[model samples]
Target: MKDSPSRPLYLAPYYIWIALFVIAPIALIFYFSFLDLTGAFTLENYQNFFSSVYLRMTLSSFWYAFLITLITILIAYPTAYWLTKTKHKQLWLLLIIIPSWINLLLKAYAFIGIFGLYGPANKLLQALGAGPLQILFTDFSFIFVSVYIFIPFMVLPIFNSLDKINPALIDASRDLGASSFTTFRRIIFPLAINGVKSGVQAVFIPALSLFVITRLIAGNKVITLGTAIEQQFLVTQNWGMGSTIAVFLILFMIIIMMLTGQKEKGGLYNGKTK
Candidate 1:
């Protein structure tokens, strides 16, 4: 059917918002990335970014983010699989999502209490005759908090995908003498790739950009590109350098999405869980 000209009008507000908030900001970043400290056109921002210190920090941030995403997927996929089998799955999912609604700073504070010197974790250690372990301001604490924070983002999509799989197909596979592992490996996992991709993307993008949790949990011990960007803009007052980092991050996100996303049979990005 031919679309009405007014169909475009229906999306006018969305287009306007996108232009103002998204395109305009990106264009400004592009402009900033090319400018020097004196506002002259230069590649100095990119040059400084590729320097050894910045490059090493950037790679470390990527590694940390990747580990956090990996751990979330490992835990979330099994939890989601079990959720699909439960009678009260909706309630379970609600419980999983409830914590996410809490303020992120609040969650960080809560972890502070739990991981503090005289906190419950150490108290338990003392009771067990083990010395109180220092956890605060460490890489372990940072990764722990990150995985805690992002696991829900991984769970929902995988649950949706698993929930949509046909029980009849499973039954038939079993009838045909396929083992449980074989059935899942052959029939289930491949069908759910899109959901897995969605979950990973949801977890990875924010984790890559994470700054506050690192500061709160790892102090200066953990530094991400996000922290570097903040340092450039807020402390160093280097807008050009900050914008350069932001552009690189945007490119990194695009690369990750392209690498992880699957093509649907129709030649589009496969995002629908079912």
Candidate 2:
């Protein structure tokens, strides 16, 4: 039998946009990564980036972003489940999404007001008879600000996934002698993994390149690949080296995406449907 027509109207525009925007930019970046300061082909920039401190900074950025992704998934799961089941789900969603509309630079500055040496957080600790705290401009501040800024990104995908689930499924699991925890573990979590994967990708990519928040919150003591890239472009004007670092970051993201894709495919083949 001949197949019915698919959604060409929807698919055509999307494919064209993807080709023009996503595919084209990635190709340009890959090409630029191999170009030298004089616009000649060279691998020296890539070699320098992988040599010593730059390599460590790049790996550290990815590592910390990974840590934040793990934490966001753990934190978001329960909140998403709760909101999905709650009566005021729309209101909860609005609360989650509102922060995202705020300017990211403004949000980073706000953290400075909270964690700066004389900021409210430190003042509160001092009032409680604790010693002067040095939190801002540290690794902890980097993690804290990055996670806070990205929490909504993590929450929304998970909430959408959880909401797609039928309440009847949970009830059926309970009826079949599964405790609430058992139902969650065996049924809910498996179904939610796709959303979790999306949330991880959303948070990790931005967090990996977060230089403004790192500068404001971490006081320049903490360095990431993003900061290095900024320094390379603005201070040293080393486009080749910066582009090489950018390529490595892209490769790292691809590796993570591949691993996540495998997990998703494996889960699907094992009869776990989202």
* TM agreement with the true structure for every prediction: 0.90, 0.83
Q: After superposition, how far is residue 177 of candidate 2 from its true place, in Å?
A: 1.5
Question: Against the unseen true structure, what C-alpha lDDT does each candidate score?
Answer: 0.86, 0.78
lDDT (tens digit, per residue) of candidate 2 on 169-190? 9989999999978998999999
Show where candidate 1 strays beyond 4 Å: 1-15, 262-274
Residue pairs in collision within model 1? none
Cα error, candidate 2, residue 160 (Å): 0.6
lDDT, candidate 1, 176-218, per-residue tens? 9999999989988987777788888787878878888987888
**Model 1 whole-model lDDT (C-alpha atoms):** 0.86
Which predicted model would earn the best TM-score?
Answer: 1
